[model samples]
Target chain A: MSEAALLHNSLMLGAILFAVGMVGMVVRRNMIVMFLCAEMMLQGVSVSLVAWGRFHNDFGGQMLVIFILTVAACEAGLGLALFVVLFHRSGNLDITYWQELREENQAAFMDREVPEEDREKTIWPQLTPSGVEPAANPEEELHRSRV
Target chain B: MLTANEHLIGSAVVAALGLWLMLPPSGERLRALGLVVAASGLGWLMSRMPGLGTWAADAAFWSLAAATSAAAVATVVSRNPVYSALWFALSLLGTAGVFALQGAQFLAVATIVVYAGAIVVTFLFVLMLAQPDGTAYYDRVGWGRVTSLLACACPAVIVGVLAMMLSSSLAGFEAGTATVAELAANVRHEEHVARLGGTLFTDHLVAVELAGTLLLVALVGAVAITAQDRQKTDARKTHGGGASR
Candidate 1:
């Protein structure tokens, strides 16, 4: 195959892999699965980058793939740590279990009952409107108070 | 348009349908059928594409692509997290193969070592620690298969169309007329790793430094988060007064 054809084929494969990752991210509820899918997407992008570099006769794309590898490693580490912590708090890795972080007015999607022990671990702070309203006229309020 | 372009569109549609079938929440019987269908569809699509220069190279590319996509599908559809991780390793390996085929031997090796070796090990460790049992509730159900399929299809179609368009437009360019063997020879003749090193140290030094710093920060953050979680658990143990569970 010609270089352009190779590049085109690789690009198409990368795009397809990326789409698969997107679908996986959307469908899977497991945090680990979601993280893996994201990595897959990165892999797809990396493929295209290398292909482009080869096509253009430049090493830039290869260098960028290296950086992508570094970032992916870091992301995986942090993501796994977060998953561990979330699992500890909730006793499960179901992403839906952490819906308390969603906007206040939105109805909660987490229908599963949390164990009493786990519930104590998850201390979701109540959002309350609390600060005192500023006076319409601070000087007038001060004078009126003095009077 | 050209016959090749028409085939590409047809292949994309078939592959999309295959993917739609392979997503989870299906019955065991249907899932098996979906796997076969998806695999065949992808394989057929790949075979239909214009061959790379040498028959051997083309075969290698097709096999690697098939393996990568198949393993990826398995990774998402597997009910067991361990199996998913293993499948992900296979997928990563296939991706590395694709990388090597693209003249990125260094990146391919790095991907194998970093992802398959380190990252996958870490994930497996977490999986074992978090869920000692076989399966979890979230693994089996709760996936909005149809909705996710629809969402994924939109981007797939758009990307396919765009790639086709770009390739078609660039068809007249003579810059990429080199055959696969010549391309391979060019890549082989160059000291890619040394050149990459030079590029890193000269052109992308700051970015390299930033990436290093980012890795350091991420490591520290991960350690801190895990440590804090441990402390919290210890505190709860003390507060609860003798294993409340």
Candidate 2:
């Protein structure tokens, strides 16, 4: 097949992937999921770039993909750290919970108005029971506790 | 008339249906049906286009496209955050495959290593840490489904129109052609990694250095933010006697 046809096909695939990611970003509520969708969109753009580079017989597109990878890694690290802090404050991963950053006197449109009863409940992580319990025998306990 | 607008209409409808299926209102049965319809529509649209490249390459393209689109839709539609993350990884893998098919071996490997290996692990760690026990209410109940759908549809239509316009404009232009010997020589010269590295170190050196600085700054910022949070928690423990909880 001609290079033009191949480029067109790859571009089409990239466009579809990008649109899917866009929909995910708009519709998903979890902050991490939204971030992942953003990365997906980046991947789609990288694919198109590489395809275009091959069509033109240039390496510039591939070089740009490398830069995109670097930026994506940086984004993930910083975004995840911020997300962890946000979770600690609100005890949830919901994006709507982070309304404090909104402009002063701006009415929050995304905030969910949960009833007082539902708001009172805290969902703490439950530790699953695992590993061996400490042996009660004194001599055996001393041997087990050697670490 | 149908031939001209087939792909645009088909892709738009498929994407819109997929988005509809992902919305909170759709039940399991409807979502499943939507998935099937959307996949079929995408397949039909792909089939309408004339086959490009060798048979092997064409087969690979179609399968990778299917995998990429399916996984992308799954990432959006899955209710469980962990599952959504896993689907995202699968989608990334499919995208890497597409890059490989496009003769970007270096980029394919880099994408797999950076996105599938590192970034995905980071996302999973955050997902695990952020959610306490079970799925959160927001995961089950997406906000503003109709509004989001409308917003997304506008862009999809715009993209479809743009793609159609681009294809029509480029129809008369033929790609640069080379003899069989010249093609072989070009392939040998375009040693994917070497050319990429040459371009990066020569023409784009300043951009590369700036990217490195950006990464360093982001690292320090992340560390500072997390460390400050820890200090605040420790001070609160001392001053409030842990009663604030």
Interface RMSD of each: 4.0, 3.0
DockQ winner: 2
Give the poorly placed runs of model 2, Cα more than 4 Å off.
Answer: A103-147, B132-134, B173-190, B241-245
- Model 1, position A83, has a per-residue lDDT of 97
lDDT for every model? Answer: 0.78, 0.76
Best model per TM-score: 2
DockQ, candidate no. 1? 0.26
TM-score of each: 0.83, 0.85
- Compose the digit string of candidate 2's lDDT tens values, residues A3-107: 667777777778877887888887877888898889888888888888777666667778888999999999999999999888887778877767556788997
Number of clashes in model 2?
0
TM-score of model number 2: 0.85
Mind giving the per-residue lDDT tens digits that candidate 1 earns over A88-141? 778888787776777869876664543122345337789898999776987787
Q: Show the colliding residue pairs in model 2.
A: none
- Model number with the top lDDT: 1
